[model samples]
Target: MAGTGKAHLRSSDNAVLRVEDLVIEYPGRDGSAVQAVSGISIDIVEGETLAVVGESGCGKSTLAKGIMRLINTSSGSVNLLGTNIAALKGEALRTVRPKMQMIFQDSISSLDPHLKVNALVEQPLKVWNRGNEEERKAKVRDLLTSVGLDPEVVGDRKPTEFSGGQCQRISIARALTLEPKLLICDEPVSSLDVSIQAQILNILQDMKERYGLSLMFISHDLSVVRAISNRVVVMYLGKICEVSPANELSERPLHHYTHALVSAVPIPDPTKVSGRAVLEGEPPSPTNPPSGCRFRTRCPAATDKCAAEEPQLTYAGNGHYVACHHPRA
Candidate 1:
């Protein structure tokens, strides 16, 4: 089930990351367990940007953190380049950590305020013992320039001195210090202004090509996801509702939930305005999600079967996969 989604995106045998039945649970009030991610599976092939899209509390961030081993997972395997790092600990985890780096949503807060920009970017290299002092300094200067920052000017200052966009660029440079094969961006541009978002996205695209990196991009912004992603995984209450090529998903979203999400993406042209899928209520509590299909509670097209039997993510032709019982045609 994990590798199946990859076929629907593209017939790629070179998967850089494979997540199988990944589940993440947190302690809830009164000793209960809140499932943040539930049996989510995905694959990101080499040089492909797989965007995980959903509203807040949809487990997008949790999934990303789980893959990076930032937080403990309840169950499942996270395979990176064929090694199941799910249970790896201590030295084993540390050795492979440099190969996968994450960019957080809050750019400024994620960076160390005390450290200068050059030191911050060079920290990964120093920790990993990549090069000598002179070599590391030259590498840092080159990375800063690649991300559109002047090393001599901005490298001396702390993250406080730069704008949100500049700080994010610094973060990108820091993440790329190891020349990581897989980069997981967890809402990296959500905090910036609309104009700043474009600049950051462009930098990310350029960096991906330059570094030959596969990206696991997590965001609630469907429009941005469409712009940057090759394939998209639509999450609802911790489960994937759809997986399709970015352009196909935007123009012909299969799942009802995905349709609602795509419809909400604001159209620039007034002449293209059409009726949107307005979801009726808020999402259900993760602690006690709806039985059968987790999204049945808020799904307008849900029927008795949707409430009685869980729908698995199955191929829906044209390299599109959908889990909804009543998918949109």
Candidate 2:
């Protein structure tokens, strides 16, 4: 059984991106197939920030690449801005790419070290023929300024000459140059300092409002995800276990896995002592996942039924959904 269900997926016309029963696989050892992402479905409405939080190797980045069509999926459909991304090929795929953009985890590696900051940001516009040379340059300056960088000071410098945070800002400017309707950020702030992370997150929120865009933010940091996302999806192994409002997930998690994840987030209370481990054990290999519930192996409440039957997402209350034999809610 995979993580969160279609129970919460809305049919509203405002949805910018939708993934239905998406399954992504890779060739494992001995030519066997490894399911990285398994039968997951999610939707993002216009102007909404959907945060995906999970442990490392939980298919967060893989899901992002799948939606971006950077990697081919074994089966499923990715509908973006009224177009079926999974069905696109060559020119058709290139034509719809401008409407969606991705900001990777590695800022320095993502940018071209040889290209100047101005040229890096303006390249997309020039390739798309967005406007004349003067117009493109003006837009680049505006984007840089909006991200709190000066065009005159940093425009001519290459990415190798700048700091990680600076390069990330440049990446953001470059991503925004196309004015994409949807942006998928894969751990965008995880590599920076705490203060810098705050700054970058603030910039993303500002850009979201200014550009009228929707976002799919993937991070392992629950606190960061809760602080910025409208809704949160919790994944374990290759499946999603819970989907809930950010605030509600923090306060009252439905699934046991969700509760364990919430409990793992550090609480900055000086007077309080260390907390007990609600969750135990590592995840199973994706190449050979456990039968029935993927999380039952680690769940304290696991039962014979949990071992025999895979649970589907059942609706709770207040827009929360969980796939667990024994949900906390």
Candidate 3:
């Protein structure tokens, strides 16, 4: 089904990245394939953050991997700076990869625990063969300072010696080594404490502004997505349920699945208790997704048509798009 979401935020004159009907699948038994991301598409404008939010196992990370060409897609296309990434091979892919970097969820996992911070940060430069030893060292110092870390002390330490937040900073530095135009961050802050999350997010915001970078930020947390995103895409079972401006989606979610997600965001005010649409049971397996609407099983407002005919994502209003037979709007 064609998703009918239009760009709410003014799209840039030139789209930095475009993903069209991208489908990713893993090999299954008997030559079948388990679909991970199914017919997903989005655009990343320069200097803007596009957040992809969903429940665990909704293919958020898989989508990120597909965009970066880490996982092969069954069909569809991903274009970065006018190049079809799916069609790229060998030297072409190698040439393009440095321009699109990913920051992993686990800082410790992304970093080489044995390597000192300087070595880790300089690793990208070394791989790209950017310069000699002295130039690489100077670049590492600049990267550390840019991410609000001390070049002298922390640069000499190992991943094991730093805090969770600091390690993430190092990971960010590694990502910045090539001065990439696009960054795909897969829940980069989910592993950190609340205070640390704020700091890291702020750093990202500053860097994004400074560099005019386009970001594809994937996370399960709605509040975090709302904070940093200009636009948000809500995913359910390997499909996009809704796409809208961040504030618009947060304030008025059109799809039942999206409403459930936004309502579940924690509200700190005790007196202003939220009346969230509590979903029942766990998300169904993607191995054999439910017929029609994937979320119908958990949706309280599900109807007969919801089980018989899947809905296409259509515009509700103001460019807000939702895919539901009976949208909340």
Candidate 4:
């Protein structure tokens, strides 16, 4: 039902989600505003996983929330399936909310601790009046089994009874109840153990294929992003610094910020010696971010121009884009 109208500017026919110049801010204690997400644009084509990576407070999660319309936005538009969801209100917003779903990082906290797993997953179907009681139960059972959980055994258990990994699987099952076209995963595997992380990731991949879904995966872990994402968007202080294919970004980063991030990824080969780019100090406060380039303060290659003139995201060959005045060769 999405993408019903004519394509707007910068909206791709193939994209399931298109965000343009999106800005989100909060009222600071003082009179000023705290800009959590600066003007940014991105497109996620159908069936592609677009990974958003950055350090803490870099606004990755805020971007995800903005896209989902969980919070109010100051300006810009979020076009989902050709509908500008940012402008939708009340029933209109509720109508489109079912098309996109979000999975949070704290799986246990995200679930309703008092409700049984079957009820939790079936609630969406009930709200939408999708099926009869027996049909809803059958769908819930299929969803639980698809997520690697045995519905017959775990269906009646409350969320508190499950481990973190199992809770996440339940969360995924709940999100898929409506068969959403888009799944926004905000650090969905960060809290689980390494072994458990792989299991959840595998399930997500399986679900994506089974449901024909597009994913917006947000995380701080580069290795995990590399493993699951097709394209990667690197953010710094609420602004995107680079966008590139996942493999290309890992192997050859163009933006200095991206270069530093890639360098921090641990290499598996003991014999391969590589120099790590250690950034100095912490990210500047978003309320009073630095002029020009947001990342210039910690970038080793920062020059006077970087402090005076803002650099826009420009192509750096082979579909890679970087927002840097002096991009690395």
What would you estimate as the lDDT of candidate 1? 0.88
Best candidate (score: TM-score): 2
Q: Write the per-residue lDDT of candidate 3 for residues 1-329, one digit (tens) a residue.
A: 22323333235357888888888999888788898888888888888799999989988899999889897888888888889998888998989999899998898878878898999999889888999999999989998998999998897788998888998898988998989999999999999999999999998998898767888899998899988999898888888888888999988888888788888888989998789788778998889987888888988778888788877877778668888888885
The per-model lDDT (C-alpha) reads: 0.88, 0.89, 0.85, 0.89
Shift in Å, residue 96, candidate 2: 0.2
lDDT score at residue 39, model 1, on the 0-100 scale: 84
Q: At residue 153, what lDDT does model 1 achieve?
A: 92
**What is every candidate's alpha-carbon RMSD to the true fold?**
2.2, 1.3, 2.0, 4.1
lDDT of 2 by residue, 53-143 (tens): 8888889899999999999998989999778899989998999999999998899999988899999999999899999888988999999
- Residues 189-263 of candidate 4 have per-residue lDDT tens digits of 999999999999999999999999999999998899999999998888888888888999988898888888888
Among all windows of 10 consecutive residues in model 1, the one with the lowest summed lDDT is 1-10
- In model 4, the runs with Cα more than 4 Å from the true position are 1-11
Model 2: C-alpha RMSD to truth? 1.3
User: What lDDT would candidate 4 get against the real structure?
Assistant: 0.89
Please identify which of the two predictions, 1 or 3, would achieve the higher lDDT against the true structure.
1
Encode model 1's per-residue lDDT on 201-307: one tens digit a residue.
Answer: 99999999999999999999899998899999999888888899999998898888888888887888899857988877788888888888888888878888887
Residue pairs in candidate 2 whose N, alpha carbon or C atoms collide under 3 angstroms: 3-239, 3-240, 4-240
